[model samples]
Target: MTSTDKYIEMKVPAFILTGLLCGLLLQPVAAQTGPAHNRPNIILIMSDDMGYSDLGCYGSEISTPNLDSLAMTGLRYTRFHNMGHCCPSRAALMTGLYPHQTGLGWMTGTNFHLPGFTDELNEHCVTIAEVLKTAGYATLMAGKWHLSHNIHAGGPQHDWPLQRGFEKFYGILTGAGNYYDPASLCRDNTLITPLNDPEYHPQHFYFTNAITDNAVRFMQERPKDKPFFMYVAYTTAHWPMQAPEEAIEKYKGKYDAGWDVLRRQRFEREKALGVIDKDATLSPSDTHPWAEEKDKAAMARRMETYAAMITIMDQGIGKIVDELKKEGIFDNTVIVFLQDNGGNAEGTGFGGPEGETRPVVPKNAAALKPLGKDEVQYAINPPVTRDGKRVMQGKNVMAGPADTYLAYLKPWGNLSNTPFRKYKNFVYEGGVATPLIIHWPDGIKAERGAVRTQSGHEIDLMPTIAQLAGAKYPSVYKGNEITPVSGISLIPTFEDKPLPPERAIYWSHQANRAMLMGKWKIVSGGILNGPYGKWKTYVSLPWQLYDMENDRSEMRDLSAEHPDIVKKMAAMWDKWAHSTNVYPMPWKEVKPPLRPDYMSTPWEYPDF
Candidate 1:
């Protein structure tokens, strides 16, 4: 009997049946028994809270030679997008579905017992790791996993990496934390303290390097019988911008020109690099003039530290690439580098204070104290640490040292996003757009250093990876029916083909909504005042239309010019929101006041 017929005749459990059927009918072109060269390994690298232009190749002043080199040898997508926030982007990336479809339309915190805000990845969706594992690929993950809620309070471990099909996992379970002493770290479901725990001697640890080290170790120990899928997520360039002293010192005076000048320079460089069109106008600075700032030195220091963090992350990426080369897998490995979202504008242009606290040491302990030492906190209303250490929170302290916790904030965020408007948490281009670099020497035969303007989103990643790995999207997983993949494989784009003509994308977060059909887009509800101040209903908001092909920066609104088109797109968005479980914005159930600050920490939101 044929293999398909034999499998059909077998009385296997429904869950096992899907995998067995996949094995028999959808065998990868590069079978496990076949030559090793046929199946390529996959590595997906994501940066947290990174702007669209934060990488060297993508027009940043930051030193990202490793990433730039990868882009040079591969493909760069100028119009790639994330879900405009961390958890939502990650949910879409992992499950190939809209965030709401995977129970993560909002951040993973209190579920509020809502359909889309469950604070955990629902079983109905299958992760890329889960799907790839069924195709004989070894799945591994390292770094921030913000898909689960209340991790420290025994949150659903079943939604953690290992339970989602990653055979091995390491890194933080929460959305944001201090890089030096990250909380809620784990290895294969076992909670472990950071390497810099006080008990450990020479308590010097950086989370970026640690994540990369674990990733390389996973590669070295992975079984050679099967190809591997590695998801390396780094929380660098996020809040609590901490870096090693030496690294921070490298860019001490890099941003003295301030954000206004820096933004212009970055815009010019992007134009020169062809990443942005020559006519792309810079968005007016929403921040104060650098020259008028009284604290010029401190502002420069903040940008310097932010640059240092990104550079250090880049250094870690170099180590990962070197490890791949060492394993003789560089040529056959697909490396995708992207960011979770646009530059964050939390904590205003300058970060807010964490609150008052007893000094851990003398106020003038040192000009440059070691990171994770002072235990200074910011934007934490309660002003308490995990160990119940009462600490100060706020911008009273200068950023950079471990003792201080602060974000680069809005001015720098505006610069990081370059010519794009707005910052993270909005549906604007600057908020959702992110740089995507794909490198595969053996697989991608397209022209090197090619830039594609085709629009794509995080949801496309899983389906694209599945296509390249010859993995099947199982209809059933673990006896539960699985949501069919919602993304189209980007394989055709690798051959310089355009995205499908009927393609449509939708996004909604905190009542900020957008829908894109081909080159036309309609966006609404990002005003930060009045009843619409935060997460309000989208029905009362006016929808603005734009022809993305002509104005990707969303400079001109076409709503008045094309009322019928706007109406149609708005209807489509409502349909998508209803179908994807994105209706009933969190505000409808709970009208919590707008966050006092923009920092993404759980404590910042009273509702959490």
Candidate 2:
């Protein structure tokens, strides 16, 4: 039956009631009718590789007055998590399901267990944009779209942002790139002119600033009457450790105390602020003592660079927020700020083929030796001696010719994680944990700076947005039944209610598999392939269990004493892995797996 006919049939009883009320009150039925739609505008701001405590509101010494103000006026989630890495997290956020459900069970590339991630987001899954757009919302997106690298192959590809439901698109298509010279920057499928020339577009060239500018333009041109959904993805706080000179200068010498003191300070502040369990213990240092000692100076500089990146990104975000307020939409717009992943532990300093197209080390060392060649400029501060002598020593200077080698040294990266254990890419708290701030002036009433103890994952993004916009999720996309939406709405938490019960959340990238069933987490990543592959699990690898209620930092592992709990959790994890087809693949050691033939499958009608 037609939609109009269905609506007419359902409205017969309501019409009869309305007629009776009209007859009694001598009023027109239209006079008492409600407005057609009242969906609020949504602005989703995402930062790349931002640590849990990088924002001023998150207890960073770095001055982020705007973001601090945002945190104060919004709802801060203490235990929110991304999917441990970028592409996968974004995929989960976009699809409202686990990363594996989106086919990006891992990173993009051939070496990982999941190779050729083009199938990561199939036509089956409806994006948050597609759902909103279908409901008449104007969709705009800015920043990273790392779902597929094929966009960089230089052709008229139909699988880009515009194709994926965004009415407008800007920013890089890859994971990481030079902030100053964005390699895969695109302006709606067209390659943006690179900022390679020193004289061209000088100040407006940084990828973060450019993205903000484009986003602002997109917003300004949008119709005020139409509800809008914008995904502002900033590539700041990622690597290449480059930022505006002013921002870098602002943080210079801020980390002289090094990682040890900084981490402790952050932990104490978080505890006092009630961002984490007051009695929660801090995780032990995961980096080797000697390595930490060797890179102190470089580490400090690296952090300085990273802080600068975050500061600038925050500044850009502030501009966007200011624009919204100026346009009188701030109060109604649902603003959500989160990170694609946790702060990275990827080796930024000692450069190699760490995946950058250009060799991280300068080609001619003798020519650029004064500028620091093989050495990644940023160093992690190591342990101090009993006498209080500084350890992890290295020269502090910018690494790149235009930017810096610019990596955020180790000590600061460790501290960026604050109370958490490892850094980005790992399944540890350090990798998955991310600071999430939700600001909706109309719907959220917790307080100016309310703290919430809700557990949020990337998958929850789609469902929450869908609920907010009052759009029904499409069960079938491109004719096949898509995986059901696995995330629940977070609206209850916004009302200051206790966080709802969470059954489980799972993650896997490469051979790394992590599962969280309530407070118990089972994470194991070792060199083995397939479900039945020989496994040399880490005995000392620490099978951790947190009360979570009491130990938000995950410092104390009650696993040894709780053997039965550990066994149960592990068994549950194994069952999930097998059911989800998460067997490891030694893609790095063998030839590429044969691509699935979509033509062999039955085709579905295209409605999405």
Candidate 3:
């Protein structure tokens, strides 16, 4: 029987009464007896809502000298992939299994009483931190912790970072929040305002800097005798583009050239850098002609602010690396950098009257002038903050300020993913592809700056780390049997080698689905159904195929020419989806409105 013949073996629930029976009987894992130097310190750094070509080495015009330097000294994987959305990507990176198998199939904002969409890290899966801890590595995390839905100040604590695996935690508990005064921000299980936090006090409170500073602090203050694993998840350039004015000044008129020129420039740079194939033609631009746009200046400013946020993040990476060098642990530390997903298409600052013009702040904002220092942030979209100022949002509102919130918008997001076709939430190469930079000075045998083209996924991170740390991936941890790692370690590729040619890489987000096997890929996606409370469905399109070897950008659809391949890959995806709790995808259990023409095939092969 082929992979398409049946669902994957039932992973977590193979044992009966897993949760109830394994109560207080769980014993703590014993420490590792291996030499500390043999097991290197692991630093896994991840960015939120970033694009495939957003790094300087990956083709973007953004200034990311620190990360670019990492690529120069380490290894860059050109064909690396991630889950097409935020939470699921984090879930995949944390657990070696795919998102659904880890019980976080969707965002942590909603729970539909479905096994896969629990909005929490279930007991069935163990995180990398948990596994590494068993090997005597100190686990520290600083940045967005979006695995749990219970973000209230006094809600369930079972799924929070401290409870899951990390010993020290900082950053927001939920997804997407104002950078200046993020909601659900925590400090080692305690919720505290940025200004009110007792341990940290910066001249100003910028979330990216805070996450970075705390990460360095955690590493500096970690037990010197014990090797550590630090996870830095930056929400920079995600939404509400807010960066220091000085950083924003660096890219004032950079993007004035517009997305068209920017796309071509990035495409050329990517080819020149060998990040993409030399013969690979640029994907057709999805953005409109920049000439006709009414507010070109404002459009350009959005990108400038976006670039500044990333540059600030790059500066933070430099700080962390500096600390590693200062402590004499730089050579022995394994640093892996990647993104959660591709560039976001959400239109945050895109709705109102166009042509860019910031009106005066609302009168009510001036009326209630209360200092928000003592207040714990509870609102995801903070209405007012940092002295009770209204958080403004408009196409006219420029992006770099504490009281303003705006996305760089969809057109610029398209540029961020230059040479790729779609945005976040779709399983197209654009949505899933990301730059994966791995640097291990003492361990990696790969040539400095070597680029590996073998496909790797976020799910591979945990396994890779486990292999390097010499950690035993648990059979049963804290009384619950853990799921087998779904991904293989890329350690072999670290020596400038190759991954198995026939291996399959999978992706499923919202109602989009895709599978890459060998040089062929099969994918399908759906449009957003208006607003909230609706189901995401794939009833609008049919399965499409591409020969990734020739068209990694997914420029041509080979579904019609190779129906047999599509059938074969689709069947394999079906089996994997069913076994991983990806089947009965939200839309299947509910009766969502269906598009007429393609409705026939959807029910037979419900996606996502």
Please report how far candidate 1 places residue 278 from its true position, in Å.
1.8
Kindly provide the TM-score of model 3 when superposed on the true structure, using C-alpha atoms: 0.90
Best by TM-score: 3
lDDT of 3: 0.81
CA lDDT of each prediction against the hidden true structure? 0.77, 0.66, 0.81
Model 1 lDDT, full chain set: 0.77
Q: Write the per-residue lDDT of candidate 2 for residues 31-92, one digit (tens) a residue.
A: 21113245678899888887787777877787777777888998888878888888888888
lDDT of 3 by residue, 1-608 (tens): 33422212223221122222222112221232146555789999999999989999898889999999999999999999999888999999999778998888988877777878777988889999999998888999999988988987777899998898899999989887888888888998888988889999999889999999999999878888889999999998798888888888889899988999988999999999999999987877676799988788777888899999999999999999999999888998999999988898887655455534332234555434544677688666665666756777777677788778788877888888878888888899779998999998877776789999888888878777887787777879999988777777777687667765566778888777888877888988754454653655435358899888899888889989878778767777777788788865676433445557844544443332
lDDT of 2: 0.66
Candidate with more favorable, higher TM-score: 1 or 2: 1
Candidate order (lDDT): 3, 1, 2
- The sequence of per-residue lDDT tens digits that candidate 1 reaches over residues 1-608 is 33322332334422233234223433344532245436789999999998888988989899999999999999999988999998999999999888998999888866856778788998899999999899889999989888987575344588888989999898888887767567677778876665333322334667888888888889888998889999999998888767788888999789988888888889999998889888877777878898887767766887888899898888888998999898787998999999989998887223225323234332543422443433332221222334434333344445665556677878889998988888889888889999999999988888899998888888888878887788878889999998766676677788888765535778988777897766788888543333433444333357888888778788888999878777766766776788788875666433334445655544232110
Model 3: worst 10 consecutive residues (lDDT sum): 21-30
